[model samples]
Target: MKYVGRFAPSPSGPLHFGSLVAALGSYFQAKSQRGDWLVRMEDLDPPREMPGAAKLILETLEAYHLHWDGEVVYQSHRHELYQQQIEQWLSKQQAYYCQCTRKQIKAAGSYYQGQCRNKNLTADNCSIRIKIDAPVTEFVDLKQGKITLPSAIAAEDFIIKRRDGLFAYNLAVVIDDIEQGVTEVVRGADLIEPTGRQISLYQLLGAKPVQYLHLPLAVTENGAKLSKQNHAQGISLSDPIPTLICAMRFLGFVLPKQIETANIDEILAWGVKHWHLEQLPKATQITTLFSNRIS
Candidate 1:
C-alpha cells in the first residue's frame, strides 16, 4: 500500500517551534518514503481557534519548504461527514448518548466507566460516546516500539460528541484519517496515549488502522510541553534556516556545520535525501532552546 502521512495542526495559535518539529518530521518522513504528505487544519474548535492562524500556519509550512500534496482540508467544513458517521454508529448501537458531566465522571474514576452505557438516553443535552466493548490494549509505534495501556484504561468509553453539539477531537480525527486514507500518522509523542482509543474507533468503524510514529515532544527547560497554552513563541520565519536546523538537531539529525547558512529549498532537499527515521530519539520529551528565548 502506498504510504500516506499527514500533519494535522489545530489552528488555536500559530505554529510554535514544537509544532514545527512535528510538521518537519512528518513532511520529511513522507517525502523520504516517496509517500503522499497532506496537511489538514484541525479547526473544529472555533472558540479556541484564532483568526488568521490557519493561513499563518500554511504560510509558515511553505516558508519552511514543507509543501503539502493536494488541497489542505479544514475540519470545520467536514462536520457533515463526522455527523454522518456518528449517526451511523448511533444507529448500530456502537455509540450512545450520555448525560454525565465531566465532574461526575472524574468523581467516579480516573477514566470513564461507561455510566451511560445502559441509560438509553435521548440526544438532547447529552454527549455521544462510543462503546469500547473490546479496547485495544497495545499497538506498535514505529519509533517508540511496543506501547501498552491497561485494559481498564483502554476500555473506558470515550466521548465522540460534546454536549455543545460540537464533534470531539478523537471522533473527528479518526473520521478524517479514514476519509483521507491516511496510511501512516507521524506526529508528536504527546498523542501516544490517544492511539489506543483511536485504534478502537478504527476497528469499530471497520477501517484499517494507520501506522503510527510518534516523534519526541519539545518541552521547556522546566519539562513542560511547549504548547500554545504555555505561551510558546511561534517559529521564527524571519530567519527560518536556523530554526529548521534547530528542529533537525532536536530530532537527533547530524548535519554539516556550514548547512546552517543554506536556504530553505537547499536544506529541505538535503533533508529529504538523507532522512533517517532511526535518528529520532525514543524519549517522549526533550528540552528545547526556545525556552531561553522567553523574556
Candidate 2:
C-alpha cells in the first residue's frame, strides 16, 4: 500500500512553534518515504475556533514551504459523514446514548466508569458512546514502542457524539483517517493516550487501523504544553528560513552548514534527503527554552 500521512490542526489559533514542529516532522517523514502528505482542518468546534485562523494556518504553512498533497479538507463540511457513521453504530448496538453531563461524570471520579453502558437512553438529547466490551489495552507505536493504558481507561465507554450535537474528536479523527485512506498517523505524543480508544473504534468498524508515530510535545518551563489555549506565540512567516531550520533541528536533523543559509525550498529538500525518524526524542514532552527560540 502507498504510504499516506496528514497534519490535521484545529483552527482555534494560529500555528505556534509546537504546531510547526508537528508539521515539519510529519511533512518530512512522509516526503522522505516518497509518500503523500495531506492537510485537514479540524474546525468542528466553532465556539472555540477563530474566524480567520484556518486561512492563516494555510498561509503560514505555505510561507514555511510545507505544501500539502491536495486541497485541504475542512471537517465542518463533513458532518454528514460523521452523522452517518454514528447512526450505523447506533443501529448496530455498538454505540449507546447517555444523558450523563460533565458535572455528573466528574462527581464519579477522574475517568468515566461507564455508568450509561446499560442505560439504553434515547439519542434525542443525549450523548453517544461506544460500548467497550473488549477494550484495546495496548498498541505498538512506530516511534514509542509498546504502549499500554490502564484497563479501566480502555473499558470506559467514551463519547462519540456530544450532548451539544457535535462529533467527538476521537470519532471524527478515526472516520477521517479511514475515509482519507491514511496509512500512517505522525503527530505529537500528547495524543498517545487516545490511540487505544481509536484503535478499538477502528476494530469495531471493521477497518484496519493506521500505524502511529507520535513526535515529542513541546512544553513551556512551567511544564504546560505549548498550545493556543496557553497563548504560545504563533510562528513568524516574516523570517521563515530560520524558523524552518529551528524546527528541523528540533526534530534532530543534521544539516550541512550551507543549508542553514539556504532558501526555504533548499532547506526542505535537504530535510527530505536526510530525515531520520530514529533520531527523534523518545520522551513524550520536550521543554523548549523560551529565549533564543523560534518566534
Candidate 3:
C-alpha cells in the first residue's frame, strides 16, 4: 500500500509554534517518503471552535509552503458516516448508551469502570461507549519506540459520541483515517495517550490499523504544552520563515546556515530532503525558550 499521512488540527485557534512543529513534522515525513499528505479540520465541537480559525490554519500552512494533497477534509461534514458506525456497533451490542456523569466516574476512580456497559440504557441524553473486550495496551511508534498504556485505561470502555450529540474524537479520527486510506498518523506527542484506544476502535470496526509517529511536543519553561487552551502565540504569517526554521530545528533538523536566508519553498524543499524520523528526540516533551520569540 502507498504511504499516506495526515495533519488533523482542531479549529480552536490559529496555528501556534507547537502546531507548526506538528504540521512541519508530518508534512516532511509524508513528502520524504513520497507519500500523500492530507489536511483534516477536526471541527466536531462547535461550541469550542473559533470562527474563521480553520481558514486561518490553512492560510498558515500555505504561508509555510506546507501544501497538502487533495481537498481538505472537515469532520463536521461527515456526521451521517459517524452515526452509521455508531448504529452498527449499537445493533451488534459492541457498544451501548452511557448515562454516567463526570462526577460519578470521578468518584469511582481516575479511569472509568464500565459502569454503564450492562445498564441496557436508551439514547435519552446518554453518551455512547464501545465495549473493550480485548484491549490494545501497546503499540510500536515509528519515532517513540514502544508505547504501553495502563490496564485500567486500555480495558476501559470509551465514549464514541457525547450526550450533547457530538461525535467523540477517537471515533471520528479512526473513521476518518480509515476512510481517507491513511497509512500512518504523524502528529505531536500530546495525542499519544489515545493511540491505544484508537487502535482498539480500528480493531472493533474491522479496519486496518495505521502506523503512528508522534513528534515531540514543544512546551514552555513551566512544562505546559503550547496549545490553544494555553493561548500560545500564533505563528507569524508576514514573516513565516523564522518560525518555519524554528519548527524544523525543533524537529531535530540541521539546516545549513544559508537556508536561513532561503525562501519558504527552498526551506521546505531542504526539510523534505533531510527529513529523518530517527533524528527526532525520543522524549515526549521538549521545553524551549525560543517559543516566546515565534510571535
Candidate 4:
C-alpha cells in the first residue's frame, strides 16, 4: 500500500501556531516519502464549530502552500456511513447502548465501570459504546517512542456514538481513516492518550493498523496547550513565511538563512528535502514564549 497521511483539523476556530506545526509535520512526513498528503475537516460537532472556520483553515493551508491531494472530507457529510458502522457493531454485539452520564462516570471513578454493558438499554436516550475484550495498552510512536496507557483506560468500553445523536471522535476518526486508507496519523501529542483505544477500534473493525507520529505540543508558558478553546491567536496569514519557518523549526528542521527570503513554495521545497522524523523532539509538550508570534 502507498503511504497515505492526513491532517484532520476540527473547525472549532482558526488555525493557530500549534495547528500549523501539526499540519506542517504531517505534510512534510507525507511529502518526504513521496506519499499522498490529504486534508479532512473534522466538523462533526456543529455546536462547537465556528462559522467559516473550516474555510479559513483551508485558506491558511493554501497561504502556506500546504496543498492536499484530494477533495477535503467533511465529517458532518458522512453521517450515514458512521451510522451504518454503528448498526453493524450493534448487530454483532460488539457495541451496546448506555445511559451513563458524565456525572455518573465521575462518581464511579476516572474510568467507566461498564455499568450499562448488560443493561439491555435501547437506542432511546442512550449512547453507544464498544466492547473491549482485547485491550491494546501499548504502542510504539514514531516520535514519542514507546507509550503505555493504564489498563483501566485501555479496557474501558468507550463510546462510539453519543446520546445527542453525534458520532464520537474515536469512532468517526477510525472509520474515516480506514475508509480513506490512511497509513499513518501525525498530529499533536495531546492526542497520545487515545491511541490505544483507537487501535482497539481498528482491531474490532478488522482494519489495517495505522502508524502514529505525535509531535510535541506547543504549549503556553503556564503549560497549557495552545488550543482554540484557550483562544490562541491564529497564525499570520498576511505574512506567512515567518510563521511557516517557525512551524518548521518547531518540527526540528534547520533551514538555510537564505530560505527566509524565499517564497512559500521554495520554503516548502527545502522542508520536504530536509524532513527527518528523528530530528523531532521526543518530549510530549514543549513550552514556548513565542506562542503568539512563533518567530
**Global fold similarity of model 4 (TM-score):** 0.97
For candidate 2, report its TM-score. Answer: 0.96
Per-residue lDDT for 1-295 in model 3, tens only? Answer: 7889999999999999898888888898899999999999999999999999999999988877788999999999999999999999999999999999989899889678988889999999899999999999999998778898888889999999999999999999999999999999988888888999999999988888999999899999999999999988888888888888888888898889999898889988988898887879878899987653333
> Which 10-residue window in model 4 sums to the lowest lDDT?
286-295
> Residue by residue across 136-226, what tens digits does model 1's lDDT show?
9999999888999878879888888999998998999998999998999999998988899999999987898999999999988889999
Show model 1 residue runs off by greater than 4 Å.
291-295
Off by over 4 Å in 4: 291-295
lDDT of 2 by residue, 1-295 (tens): 8999999999998899899999998999999999999999999899999889999999999988889998899999999999998888888888899988889888989678878888878877899998888899999998889999888788899999899988899999999999999999999888988999999989988999999999998898889998989888888878887777877778888778899988889999989999887889878888886422234
Residue pairs with backbone overlap in model 3: none
CA deviation > 4 Å runs, candidate 2: 290-295
Q: Give residue 264's lDDT in candidate 3 (0 to 100).
A: 85
Return the number of clashes found in candidate 3: 0
What is the clash count for each candidate, in the order shown? 0, 0, 0, 0
Predicted candidate 4 versus true structure: per-residue lDDT over 29-126, tens digit per residue: 99999999999999989999999999999998888889999999999999999999889989988899999999999988977988999998899999
Task: Supply the TM-score for candidate 1.
Answer: 0.96
What lDDT would candidate 4 get against the real structure?
Answer: 0.91
Candidate 1 achieves a global lDDT of 0.88
Sum up the clashes in candidate 1.
0
> Which window of 10 residues has the lowest lDDT sum in candidate 3?
286-295
